[model samples]
Target: MATPAADLANWIPRLLATWRAARRTQRRGGPRPPLDALLPDELREVAAAVTRLSTGLTRERELAGARYLDDERLLGAYLLFYWPISYLQARGVLSELPRLPRTVLDLGSGPGPLAFAALDAGAVAVTACDRAKQALTAARDLARLAGARLTTRDWNPTQGTPLASLTGGTPPDLITLGHVINELWKGEGAEEKRAALLESAARALAPGGSLVVIEPALRDTSRGLLRVRDLLVSRGFAVRAPCLFRGACPALLKESDWCHAERAIDPPPLVAQIGKAAGLRKEAVKMSYLVLAPPGEPWAAPPPGVVLRIVSEPLAGKGRLRYMGCGPDGRKGLALQEKHVGDANRRFETLKRGDVVALEGTEPRGDGLALGAGSRVTVLAEAGRPVPMPVDGQA
Candidate 1:
């Protein structure tokens, strides 16, 4: 009972084989020695057309093969590697640089894969850009699957000044060039082209932000992962990779590609509803400790000797919570419960980018100052003076 549609689909492979055979014949004996050996421009149009078709076909298959990826946890593991790699690189840069990145920008973001992943993981927003309109459309569709917002652009990195326009008015916390660097470098004046691309990336980088380049680990060192690593290092990035970072890069791969697509399915309506609410709202405020006021006034107790600044603000509906303290490097530090001597639920949103606040009740740790991610603050400071802090709005 198979319809003509199904019948034609079954015959696709044979048709493709026949077409490829004709193409091979033309390349091998019809004036050209070999398809790849020909001058680059000779195959530009054909290559681009093939690339578009391939991408379109792949998407169609992914949509059709949804059932296959549904039960695949292995695919999730491999997809997770990209984020950790980005985090490690960003952290490595921060160790040597003065500022920390506040945003992540993913370029050549295929299907908005890494961009949306970042948003789910931690980034405030994900800007997914690509040269192909079709690719951007696919990426936007993918973003819809997650109920997340994405800003997409049509851009080809190889030609035109579109990169400059795309990045205008805003600098990115991190610039990611995944799999596209090699293709961009294939034309004439490859070095100049690469430098031009890097210069653009460098210009768009926020203070202390990193430019991430990841390519296939192919034999062509000049056009593969090795080249990307070297190029980034030469641009003054503190390079850290599986090859460089000792045991830092874990194998995110599994037996099959299933690991990467496990999360592709839409969650149940109830679960999705709850998740959407969670995604829409600000996270719960975590109070380090409750500072008790003596009788009439809450300010009776003298402020602690050393007060930390408030790196984050409180939630809109909650006023009893407040986060205070800056890391030794001026980066925000989370106010932990173990360090607070007062009531629980006093710690507000983990300290964010700005806000000069302090804590009271506990003593400062070591040299009366804490450094690094998990620092302790005995007292939380306030902005200018300890006026009543405003409640945060529902995010």
Candidate 2:
């Protein structure tokens, strides 16, 4: 039998190596390298660590019926990259804008990443508020380092009231609700919190101000998302087209699902698009961004096209792979491209693995017609492999 000392000796080097790899990946301006790249001997141990962290997160939320601000630490090494990854998706809309907000309010700004994003986008004032003092402290320290001012508040979702203390006794020019809304809706105190947040954001929004609420698109039936979406719409906010949050759907895409043991990765090009798909145009003060708006403004609209599921053909051509996929509307075809590209864009090349071809043409070839040429599509990967359909069900 292996003695404890022997086991420790055997694992320490691998553990240290993995940790160093994670740290390096964090600082490299990208996402955590695929979980597999960690040394194989260390993978099982790291996987266990990931499982423990995931379990802790779920269990704490399930037990407490609310989020623990400290749990945000689970994202410590990763939070750095997560911001830029998200920014890449939103930049398309933001970059075309003529200006950024002079004053910005980031609700539930744990660690203040969003606050900094707003500032980087040229906001004059970035006020980040969160209920967790520890999280606020971290945010403050970072803000100080960046030479940006931060105002923290004791705003709890359960409070069901605005942090009236820091509303400046007036509305804010821009407000951002990032990831905190869903946390507010997970249990007994949810409805009140949701109502309060919605009402507060609406009432405190400057006449021509905009409110951006972003969250992971993890809800089934888009119920929680739709509730807030509808509430905003009813309050006169318009829904923007192409659900802003589009990307890979994790195995835990649903609210209560949990994974056990070593399961296959849900696969890629797994791109989970998560962002605010719609922003209400406050019309009066006249934001210049409205000029670049795509036809419909402040309206509830679905994304332009359906997601396409692509199955990997690792045996295909040199330096490339073969893929077969179907749109969310159920049209199927084959895609020839690098396995790394996670979404369906015009750049994907034309090739074949069978009858399916990545040629320039409509899907379903006039027979099923799910997606037309030029439709925006996402390609999700499963267990590091791509498939042609959403195995978990419709996306």
Best by TM-score: 2
Q: State the local distance difference test value for candidate 2.
A: 0.42
User: What is the per-residue lDDT of model 2 for residues 1-395, given as tens digits with 9 covering 90 to 100?
Assistant: 33222322332233233335334233445455443134333333434433444344344434222444454333332232233333332332233232456677778877665666666656777678877666676677656545577777767656644545667775666677665666665655564457457656756766545566555433331345445454444454443222222222222234663111111111111111111111111111100011111112333222234443332222356755334443334323343345434344434442211111223334544333333344343323222121232212233
Give me the runs in candidate 2 sitting further than 4 Å from their true place: 1-53, 56-67, 71-99, 161-164, 187-196, 221-223, 241-395
Model 1, residue 275: C-alpha shift (Å)? 30
- Lowest-sum lDDT 10-residue window in model 2: 283-292
How far residue 191's Cα lies from its native spot in candidate 2, in Å, is 5.3
Tens-place lDDT per residue, model 1, 55-128, is: 43234422211221122221221122122222222222222222333466677665454464455445576677
After superposition, candidate 1 runs with Cα above 4 Å error:
1-102, 221-225, 228-395
Task: Name the lDDT of candidate 1.
Answer: 0.38
Candidate lDDT scores, in order, read 0.38, 0.42
